[model samples]
Target: MEDVMSLEGPVLKVNGELVLIIPLSAGGDELMKCSRGISEVQGEFLKIVIPEWLAGMLGIEEGDLVCVHNTDGKFHISPSSPRRVH
Candidate 1:
């Protein structure tokens, strides 16, 4: 997984994997649950590629869904909006 760190501190330790953090934009202490398939798992790290438009943003308040898909024996990472909550 990719090393996720901020100047303040490292939120996650690098296990040779990558993780995406979507921070809520709303001015409240709220949390959203995202569910996506394991498209690719690399050395204890996962490569979750969302949509190009939602590539970089903050928060899960935008929606209540996330999708994870594997295509043709390959890990096709893409953005998904799930209907159910995990």
Candidate 2:
């Protein structure tokens, strides 16, 4: 949507919560604020409450690669293990 056209920035975790501060490119060029609650944490996967609008734009589904980056550092996630499948 044009409302959230330019939403891209570093990701952060505060008080055991994940927050994404996206900047809005339209309507005043202000920052579009949004956050997702932590539903569960399993091993390397963190179940977060992703916004429907964002989900559609990102084309993310049940299982997908979600790279989390912050001032501390960055990390990448894959659906499958790095080891041999067979």
The candidate that achieves the highest TM-score relative to the unseen native structure: 2
Note the residue pairs that clash in candidate 2.
none
Model 2 Cα displacement at 36 (Å)?
Answer: 8.3
* lDDT for each residue of candidate 1 in 3-29, tens digit (9 for 90 to 100): 222111112222433343323342001
Models, CA RMSD each: 14.9, 12.9
lDDT of each: 0.30, 0.34
Q: Pairing residues by index, what is the TM-score of model 2? A: 0.29
Model 1 score (lDDT): 0.30
> What's the C-alpha lDDT at position 12 in model 1?
24
Q: What TM-score does model 1 achieve against the real structure?
A: 0.23
Lowest lDDT 10-residue stretch of candidate 1: 4-13
